[model samples]
Target: MSEWVDVHFQALETCGKRARSAANMLTVEDVFQDSSAKKPADAAQASMFGDLSHSGALAGKVNDVWSALKEELGTGRSRLQGVEKAIDQVETNLRKATKAATV
Candidate 1:
């Protein structure tokens, strides 16, 4: 392989590794919808603040974001696979060209 092609292919391999790592870093969680906010226990606070019931709301929102990010990460992983396959095809074509020239 020519030095230029070799370098470019190596760079692709490195990029693929980085992409995979990034995908793995995003974790999926059980996302849920926020239920109706319940009335607060503190009657005075409840009156002052109204319904603020959601103990689960914050968790649900976080999980929802995590799940979305995980899906996006899966798409990125698929793109990385495509890049790897394209690199392989390019290398194969280069080798074939070199063989034909020598023959």
Candidate 2:
């Protein structure tokens, strides 16, 4: 029993693939494109509101959140892939050890 190694390879592979797929779904620019709201906000301020500071601040915060999320998604994908690779290596090593013991 001690010699047997139990690993759910399919689950790990699926998790890694899903992580990569999720990260690939959104670009950094799509997450938080600077200058995207700038023109519109500036125009609105120039035309109507003399003070758009609060609105600008809110937008900034939203952008910050999006940027952080985008970064985390990439990081998560890398970490998931690393975990999968590590698990695969462990399984391979276990198999080799078992085969050698049998021989």
The numbered model that scores best in lDDT is 1
Worst 10 residues of 1 by lDDT: 26-35
Give the best candidate by TM-score.
2
Give residue 73's lDDT in candidate 2 (0 to 100): 67
- Candidate 1, residue 40: the lDDT equals 27
Per-residue CA lDDT of candidate 2, range 9-82, in tens? 45545665675566454555444555455222222222243456577666666667766776886787677666
Q: Report clash pairs, candidate 2.
A: none
Worst 10 residues of 2 by lDDT: 38-47
Q: Which stretches of candidate 1 lie over 4 Å from their true place?
A: 1-52, 55-57
How far is each candidate from the true structure, as Cα RMSD in Å? 10.2, 6.9
Report, for every candidate in turn, its global Cα lDDT versus the true structure.
Answer: 0.59, 0.57
Assess every candidate by TM-score.
0.50, 0.52
